[model samples]
Target: MNAKILETENVTVSFEKLSRRASELKNCFYCGASLPAISGEHIFNSSWGGSYKDKNLICCQCNFSFSNSTDKAFIIYVQAVMNSWVFKGQRHQEVPKIVLENEYFLDQGAKLKLKQPLIEDEILPDESIKSRLTFNSKSEAKRWIEGDGMATWLGRLPLAEEQEKLKKIIIETQLDRTDAKPQPISYQLNLREQYRSTAHTILKCLGFFLPEWVQGDLTKPIREFARYDKGDWRTFAIETKELFPVAEEATRILGLGVHHNSVEVYWNSSTKIVVGVLTILNRLKRSVVIAQDYSGLDSILYVVEGTHGSKKPPISVFTEFAQKQFSLPLLSVQYFSSPNNIYQYFHDELQVLMGIYYPIDAMTARLIQKIEKNNKKNLKLDQVSLEEYLNLFLSFFLDLAKVASTSVDMTKARSKLIEYGFANLAHQHVGKLYTDPDVESLMTLAFERTVKDFHAEVLNAG
Candidate 1:
């Protein structure tokens, strides 16, 4: 935008206004088009009310393409954490349409709703289409840089004169420009650009899909899984981060009468695990079904400690409740930080399950099959020792491709790891193929996280 609105506050968004008129119907929300298309879109704003479709915006053809079964599930996920977001708890007014349609859009995991977009107006999408983008409205620009939010009840600081002046400049700029056409200004510390930068970097590395709601309010990262016409819940919702002392938390809350189930996706902090667990933990009796991970910690462990016994410890809620009620002590443990003795404590049925996860299994199979089928004479699987590596790489690629289709290319993949076997794959990683193949990166992450944990455990033990 042409406006050089000064930074009034420490925020990224700044205010700029144009005399008002209703929205123009020139471009399609899903696919920007000038042609004769369906008017007055049918849309789904997944980020509404935890997740509800309070709206829609689309053209006819685009709507049809998104009608398959898994579409709703994916769509629901797109609305994750979209309720209302406050960067450090500071926010600005609604973004103007002109800013969204500009060359520099702010979306990281940018997916246009087929028939409806959450924010029907123009929204910015950045380099990585699968990253979450949060752009401040003109009024919010100053706060972003200043990093100000509502004053906490206990510690309120009076603003200095200069700071107050800066805030006025920024907010005043949100008003319509006095003379000529308005424009967006850029300073090195611009919040919108900086936020876009961070969001883009995170998504690209994680191969994550940024749902529309992530930037709103749902204070957490959200991971999207592609559903291939599965007849689960026109969409089904699973909180990968949802775990507890959950299976155990169940029995305590439900009084041993209710039954429960839980699932797991380790190392993913996508959504607030606390909220997801609390919502469902009591509903299901100390029971949860989890996606067993490659990591050895994927076992289900029961707390043999009875609620009434001295050795048994109650959950956080009960402990806190009891403390509040009688000034007593009921113990609890972080779900993830469970003791290793869990194997000795729980039943055999709740064991380390190497059962391949559904989409992951389906994905692995396809990747393996494709690589096997596509092996040219010179580029055979034997030549690369890549049967396993290719399988792993393709599984990850297909996953990323589903969300960031534009950023990935399986057809163009050429890895020496795919040209040689295990030892050669190792050599290739240490040599030339480490950057693009992905298997190397995956292994690196696994190894690094493992090593870090090992060191942490040792430090704790000491």
Candidate 2:
């Protein structure tokens, strides 16, 4: 089944056209203010390489407010991950100061007091002592490097009393990283606020695609909920209990294909639920999903489906009737990309997995039974050749490994596969896939095969 690949040129063209249309929108979608003056609002923050912006959709005041409040929180939440990735081809200028035993480890243990801009030669390959040689006072310099390699200080501590005072100030200002040994650095995150920020971003993006009619009525409510109103927006931005395996696979695929953040919106008409997903920096961090109840808002759903020539892809939409029965809408939007075949494969696999484990409600049991019956009809085992079965099995395991890696430490990902029940499938045919002797070898093989298969799928689909 040959599929039309969305080329980079095509994506850029489509996105630019969309941006132009969005810019023509007259009112601030969040505040309903007249856009007499507007500012370019990036769907994702520019710090993370998001360049797409709409020039006229948002009022300057709304844009500034979001930037200062919710957007600031979002940036803080992902700053650590962004720094680790060195996003936008630049290293972070300022990071959380790391202090060890009252001594600062500036720039990842560089031990340099930066007084001026870094020149080309300062970015050295080897670890060498590079001093800026400027100080506010001799006493400040003495206190800063009391025990370091460059602490010679011309053989004397001239301002002993002042240096002691500076040392005491360091003790008060610095965070002690020395005592927290053998443990990973932890950041205190306000989960509720982060989720709220996620909700606001999702709604803000939705404002772009939604029709003016739907936007006219819903924008005010969405704006209030996303901005000022403290009503339970948590329902829209609930976190998954377990990490999504498909998110890991999609992140990998997207990283290789698109160099920008991707947004996907999904709506279920029966349930009146709209789900928005935002993937940042190609999934170096977790993907955020926001689901909103729009059951009575069929017009909005219709508008989204018809807007921007948004055609449905050639795949089945995984809907859970169970949620509707329970008066709960369960819509999920995932932001990831894959080659056509791999995309479809993961889509089908995730549907089955979700139907099995993360069922929407009690009615999901019935939905699962129906899905299994339909699968039996659609997938003919007897017509499947031995080689095809092996390829499919290998792809499944590889995807599982990829997902496991994202959920936990990479070193322990293989073991986690076994603990998470992936070993059972492999054990039946390929022996213990994650056992000690074969674990390392199998893990390497799985990752290699996954990449190889992904390329093959891309080629075949194209």
Candidate 3:
């Protein structure tokens, strides 16, 4: 360069290009594994008619693991709610019969069924042994006989001769009817795993909506509890004070076409927490803390409604998006007293569901549609004609009974509906129907009788 300075100017030039192909790869939130492009995790399980899914939330391996562990436990925990709602989602798995005390089963139709394959023996005056075997189905009877029916009768492993003798007795006995005394029925469910699984649902929802936020350090406790069964789940999950909607309220909020599930995430600014609320079949409700000690945009609400053929986008509201809409911060309400209180809440919810559920088959669906249409039309006109009111009440409540598992005569059901409707209307103004004690008592007795008749019909039909 010094030598060139004498002759001409030394020239130097450099050209540099920077290129970056932004990585779009997604990783599992739980296991931190590369996620398959085809894999998706359901925020609400498919068993609840949930179609919402997140592709990058969790890897297939973690999803499968949860399915086998916490997911299964959660299903067992809500067996009664699932069976009562008749929520046979895409999988359409048979609703498992709920086990009850004293060798009984609560069927999907809320019928108390005697667990079958029963053997009763009697000693006759002639000192002869008479035995009877009762089974639910031919397959059950065959399986018992082929496996160890004789062993059961002998109270131990049976000898070859003893088995032969039992077979002869079974073959010779004729089919006859016998009375069975109803035993007290109660249920007990373990809540520990269920609590963990419930918290898992909230975590999945958080991962679904706010992937980056959920992966941060704040959500680690819940993620650990949900995935590896680590940590005290109660700190993150609790049954909230939110009351599950009754059937009428459910009908108003969610359409009658299908059982609906809902997941809502909101920030409790007062508590510096992010909370996720889950409601299934509009019956079981719980709240889970997704994040703690959060300093972020405060007002946030994310809601996803899961239903049959659901396609609506999630409703997301943020402080920046709608400052005036939710200026008031959402404060935290105290959760239920203890996790154990969930048992009573579940009991009450099950009782309500069993009392109100009428399987919505094609016929019931059509009837409900008609009633809803008529009610809407009447309400638009500001007054319901007597005929319209009576018809709506009868079709909605009483007509459904006819198409149910129990066969109540249409004429009788209609008459009863009208009778109750008139009694309810006669006691008060249009808005206060069924508010009077006498009307309520009458309705209560009618429902009790209807339930009793249904039980009897189911027992006899079987």
Candidate 4:
């Protein structure tokens, strides 16, 4: 069967007063071509569980082209997170295949399977051949035995007499289970393409929610960077030091059985810059420079729950329900200016992305159960014991991938870890198996070592 391509749905409702004005997207937002008789363009990739779209913002040519280029890159980049979340988009066929080190596949329900089937035959001293077989599924084992075992093992086709003997051996073989090791995954992200796609997302959202600014001259820089790769992609959606605004509120909303997708367009009057932030599956957070010297809407928060069977309209803070629930914050007036500082921001983003496999609740439950067991034994769980338990917990559950390779600066990552109360404590408890050093340097060094061991290289598309 063919795998399902990610897809989204068209949305017609608008937010606040923007709903009153007619849409001005007569031409494609990216190529300026006449609108095609195709489905709307998704603001967020459907692979990231986005359901909302705008029918008039982009033509079929631009839409199909992007679906094959930068858009596809963005989807592939986040496949690990999407699969870990068990998030099925509007048309997801099955969980994506997340292979680690080219040997194991991460299956649904937090399980792992060997990609290659294993078969072993050993001749005993008594001249008897002891055979063993392993496969990811029973069907695979059955196919191999019935289709190829006769030629491979016996060196001849299994006739009526030999077939009975082979069948008897297969029926008598006992079943066993396979265990998987916790190894670091090696993966790459083309930052150039990812940022370009993120910038594209912001622009698409602007066309859908704020049609008044869709064709403004001030939007030229962003449009060129997103569509034609005209400028430095880094400058368009620069990484900031903080999480996207109102992230806490968004997390709460996501916990209620929905994957969150949102686009925040805010005008920072102090800096005179209009910034756009896109959050997908509440995992990827990107901020982009939409326009400079702006004079438009002060703030527009567009949120949609992206999942199957969701028919609710998009949410805006201007609505009474949203105003009471979400307290939107102003976008940052500035981002880190230095390259070293910028690289640290990306490292932090990688850490957040890794949270997709961090089973916090399950780990918490295990820790609690351990403590309770110790209590029943009348042995107090001391700090040392707790720390050792945590080390094991992190080692067992956190599915890590080295996303960056170039050495920039660990100073900022160190400081951020300390700021989050992870300095001395975390260094003593976590990452001991990988870095075996202090937490400050361990944070960066371990990630580099993990990737190096797997022979993975992450590079910029430029």
Top model number, TM-score: 4
lDDT of 4 by residue, 1-462 (tens): 112222224212223533411146788867788864377776677776667666678888777777766876556435655454555665578866566776677664335677877667999999999977667766666666678754676687767766666556666766554322233566455676777777787777666656667688889898888887888776776544333455456565444322567667665544567777777655566778888886433444554545553544355443111222233345454554677776676665565444332333223234444545544553333355434433432332232222222332233333333434344445455423322344324433443343343234221112
In order, what lDDT does every prediction score? 0.27, 0.39, 0.54, 0.56
lDDT of the structure predicted as candidate 2: 0.39
For model 3, what is the error of residue 207's alpha carbon versus the real structure, in angstroms, after optimal superposition?
3.0
Candidate 3 lDDT, 338-415, residue by residue in tens: 556757876665444444442323233444455557645544221254456455544544434443434445455445
Work out the TM-score per prediction: 0.18, 0.44, 0.55, 0.61
TM-score ranking from best to worst?
Answer: 4, 3, 2, 1
Error of 1 at 330 (Å): 12
Note each model's CA RMSD in angstroms. 27.8, 18.4, 16.6, 13.8
lDDT of 1 by residue, 237-331 (tens): 22123333444455545534111212211222122121222121112111111121212111121211121112211111111111112211112
Looking at model 3, residue 442 earns an lDDT score of 54
* Candidate 1 off by > 4 Å: 1-361, 365-384, 395-400, 409-462
Task: Give candidate 3 regions above 4 Å deviation.
Answer: 1-25, 51-53, 102-104, 112-188, 239-251, 256-258, 296-300, 305-331, 335-462
Per residue, candidate 2 scores C-alpha lDDT tens digits across 69-160 of: 56555453234333322233122355333322222222221122334222222434686544334343445544455754233433554366
